[model samples]
Target: MMELAVVWSVLIAQTMLALAMAFALYRMARGPRAQDRILGLDTLYINAMLMLITFGIRTANTVYFETALIIAVIGFASSIALAKFLMRGEVIE
Candidate 1:
């Protein structure tokens, strides 16, 4: 009974995350300003990480968790770089 609930919850979470990702993608593509697009990209990365976490929970796999961690690190760095570039017109000094 509890296992069934867990399975259903994970499925629902993944579905929601996927929908959110789609919306984020649309925003990133359609945004008129660079900042808006960057915000959308940030949201996308967060949703993607959560989706991977849900997959790890559903499958009892560590790989998905590790991959999510990698995505987190890379996403954070990239977002920072993008923001800095937008502000200064370059990523590095």
Candidate 2:
């Protein structure tokens, strides 16, 4: 059935996102430089957002989608701040 296919696909997507998150964590932890670590954090947030999206699809819930949106907004703002800090040694002028 279509429902079964949807469930299975969402399960697979979630599994992949989990694996990606693991890799991102490793990169963030062991990165030799600030830029590499920042890149890892960026990837981690994106995977987290996608994981939430897959959960929303699986559960047919709107809350997961809204939470994912919040994560995305916060992640983007944090990444910009980090980049600015790395470049100028200050987040704000």
Candidate 3:
């Protein structure tokens, strides 16, 4: 049934997101360089956002979509700051 397929898809997506989050956390903790840590954090953020979207689909609610959008904007800002810091050795300098 279509309903069953949707459920399965949601389940699979959540599982993959969880795994990705775990891996990102590992990288963030173990990265040898600041840039690697920043990249891991970005990946973690994006994966969390996707996980929220999947939750929205499973619950048939729009709130998660808004949350995901906010997360995306915040993630973008964080990545930009990190990149700037890498380039200048200081975020504001």
For candidate 2, write residues 7-77 as lDDT tens digits: 99999888999999999999999998999999999999999999999999888899999999999999999
Clashes of 3: 0
Give the number of colliding residue pairs in candidate 1: 0
lDDT of 3 by residue, 1-93 (tens): 999999999999899999999999999999989989999999999999999999999998889999999999999998999899899889885
Model 2 stretches astray by more than 4 angstroms = none
CA shift of 21, model 2, Å: 0.8
All candidates: TM-score: 0.95, 0.95, 0.91
lDDT (0 to 1) per candidate: 0.96, 0.96, 0.95
Ranking by TM-score: 2, 1, 3
* lDDT for each residue of candidate 1 in 1-93, tens digit (9 for 90 to 100): 999999999998889999999999999999989998999999999999999999998899999999999999999999999999999999999
lDDT of 1 at 2: 100
Model 1, runs deviating above 4 Å: none
RMSD after Cα superposition, model 1: 0.8
Where is model 3 more than 4 Å wrong at Cα? none
Superior by lDDT: candidate 1 or candidate 2: 2
